[model samples]
Target: MLVQGETTFEDCLVSLNVLCDVLLTVAKLMYPLPEFVLIHKDESVLKDIESLENFRLNVYKVTLSQDCELYDVELHTEPNYPTLGKKFGVKSIAEKIRQMTDTDIEKLLSKGESESPLIIIDDVPIESEGVHFFFRVVKQTQFEAIAKQGCVVLLDYTADAALKDEGRIQEITSRIQKLRKEAFFYVNY
Candidate 1:
């Protein structure tokens, strides 16, 4: 497990980038691995394309898989990417107040202190925004995505539901081969 180089110990444990790359290449040659591994942001409620794309790009930087067919720089933004908007802060008010009616502004301002729980900063209610990242491992035609955050390298292994059936099939095939080898049929008969 020791990599002889100037790499840090933390990099050795968390990253092991070069080793993982080599092992993944070898694994592909040694066994039937997935053809594609997709790293994507988790389920998003944002409707903004710019924001979503930016977040996905950030995720691509932290992802650790390489040499897979699913590795694409633009895959994160392929289907859709949401935009960014000011939610409930001064920015929201400044930007949206012009589009809102007088009644709408009044209603927002006249809400009771106990009306709803709000996170306020500088006396302005600011909406919270967050995005989760997920990994999708695809083998042949099957694929499933699992949500996670930060880095999503090893976490994809246990979350690959698409590979479970293949694993069982491989196991059964191996067992049947073993049984066939054990059985001596009429070869010369």
Candidate 2:
């Protein structure tokens, strides 16, 4: 029998085996992995998706060429929580942060000494004067253009690209796996 809070040697082995299986499945795809993948979902959409207590979405980036198809999937639990500077339409907070004096920075770090928007840095609480403007998360509607870039694949949640592609890739992966299992020409060799 297994205890509620305790883990046994066999339990650890099972966890490791599952991890290995996932890795092996990824390797079987045989595609050149990209350096990174980017996800661009609106804040409202993200919130709605998270409303389901146990539902976690799997977003995948698929690249296809004449002879190769690659699927890259990442599971992200943390939502994007930018500083209040973004929410307030402050063009560049980096410059303001850099210009702050050591004392001002210290105020943000002091326990309960500073208010929000000033003390929050990237969703983390800091100890600041005038820094309460930094704690709030940026609303996507107010600052979407700033996040766009060139050459990178952005899975935009507002459009069909992200949704359409994810379904297609899953279908392809399933078909490939089915074919591999059914192929029997090499059974004698």
Candidate 3:
């Protein structure tokens, strides 16, 4: 099959920003909660509140559904706007991506890299040359579920040392849970 229009390194960055925002939003839901803003009522009028607005996250995936022939492939990034807007006092994923220089993207996309944020273009597996361009979601990004009007969590094993060995952690947790069950402590998943 013939491939058309080059997929630049910058395109990868845009995609990553979208993905990271989704992941972080999931993190907020499952693990740590976002800061609770206690709106003061004495001066003017306000109530204590955390964000109650619904957030939308859209991920564009490469597909071969319509046509067989290769066509002009442009990176479409309109969906990531809202997530970028909810910045945590730090640069939003989108803005951080915007701030990156071309050289920075080049380096980030280069081969022989020992780092997090593994970049994969299309559904292809890791190659020796590293982050080359193609288009499609990787296996890792495959969505098993989408929670509407509710919270969801995505676990990150690498973030903590204890979490690195997930099987061991799960086993230990299971054992503790069994002991709890024997002790009349019943918690549900």
Candidate 4:
């Protein structure tokens, strides 16, 4: 999780090396010879990967586009309207997601790479219809869906206030572990 520093890029690279060593040690203990380790590093951490571990680690750098925005069309849906207006069309949401995903696909394609399982992590609030609509669109696009992958995971830090009930953390952790076994990875931020 090291990022660009206030001074220079070299400092950031040094920080990333330190972080990667720590992460590699932890990963080795967690999984039995993990074939592919996807490190969500930005441009700053790219050069530092080689210096971190002796063994090869399959790294995927995440680059978020500045132009795209998550538009909540539900806000525009007027009250007393039967169902909703065409302005909140599922097709629009699907198109936006397609464009966003296409950017990443194009980058991979340029490097002569093929498609892999994708896991998206977001921290936004989830509403009922919104969740259903999103999953529907994702399925139509042929992307496998998971809750925390498609939405957000309630973190341990919010355990006391947000999820105060006893055994809540344990419950969430179990579910996350189940998902890890089935899906690409857990998006526990």
Candidate 5:
């Protein structure tokens, strides 16, 4: 799973492509055995894949349930006219996402099964103090209540320059490497 964030659509596409390449390389190196790799997303990034070569992975474009779709009001504006309408307030966006999440939870419960090992690639920064509160509420109210569920929430912070600087990237990469090594050690133990 890869999440990408940027002020411009092109930047987001570049970040996503880079992340995809990294993931593909890691998978190839770690697992020599043949395995299926799938890419799932909305149709937004379809054209961007034409530039990526050497990875023979199947891509699936599925429209998420209306409730599951996290709408970004920022993306709705025309390039020349960017204004937050009264209806497009931050509170409104949060409410919309929450409503959609609730609907998804209901649908999952009705099916009598859960989507285990579910990965959510959110282009939004989950570490923001304001957003963290909302995420905790969502997890406690809806996600955690679901049974037999495992979630990997990958947050992309490329939108913020401070978070994507060389030093920060190196720090994040080191932490991720440490986590992977620890997991491997535990598995081998």
Candidate 6:
């Protein structure tokens, strides 16, 4: 997002707003929608996914790989926690996490969780292989009617560029599928 090295916070805010608008535009083009809202610093959206109306379509929660950076670990101690609650922010840090390279993360997965002991409570050490920001999905169980209508709900936390790139990929995939069906391919085998 800071590609051009903007010199002011105002520039950053404006950039973020522009990014959100672009993302919404891309999402709308790719997905069917009755409504879409761009929320800034809003947590109310996470309360209940089932209550959300999904344009008479099935909603699915898609989870991708964990993305973490050096600043990502700083949420453990900050103004963010005192106001937003501990659970609202990333709460733990592993040794070398701030300095760990992508190669390090990949090597960690290959080895095991035994290396990084994250926390200790009541004198017992709690081990963590790695830290990740988890995005959990709340299903719409109460609305049987909406479920039958095919409402797919998705929440993504990727960068704006990544989102746009993925949307384009989805568009290509959809076109390929459409062409495949149009060619009269048999389902057998």
2 or 3, greater by lDDT: 2
Cα RMSDs, all models: 19.5, 17.8, 26.8, 22.4, 22.1, 20.4
Candidate-wise lDDT, in order: 0.38, 0.41, 0.35, 0.33, 0.33, 0.39
- List ranges where model 1 is wrong by over 4 Å: 1-33, 36-143, 152-169, 176-189
Give candidate 4 regions above 4 Å deviation.
Answer: 1-31, 37-43, 54-87, 99-101, 104-189
Q: Which pairs, if any, clash in model 3?
A: 122-136
Candidate 3, 55-166: lDDT as tens digits? 3211112111221112221111211344323422223344444444445554554534556444332332333233222222224532231211111222222223433344
Candidate 4 local lDDT, 1-189, one digit each (tens) = 656545577877998999997775434332112122222224444345435555543222222211212211111111212222332444444443344444443343243313231222142221222321221222232122222212311111222332333334545566568879798775768
Instruction: Show how many residue pairs clash in every candidate, following the order shown.
Output: 6, 15, 1, 0, 1, 11
Candidate 4 local distance difference test against the native: 0.33
lDDT of 1 by residue, 1-189 (tens): 556777777877767787786665434421234432433343232223334444423122233343334542211111011212333333443444234443443344345445552234345543322111123344433333443432233222232554655555665676567777789543454
| Candidate 3 structure lDDT | 0.35
Clashing pairs in 5: 67-100
Better of 1 and 4 by TM-score: 1
Candidate 6 C-alpha lDDT tens digits along 42-80: 234433433554434322342212122311211121122
TM-score, per-candidate, Cα-based: 0.20, 0.21, 0.16, 0.19, 0.17, 0.22
Best by TM-score: 6
TM-score of 5: 0.17
Highest lDDT against the true fold, candidate? 2
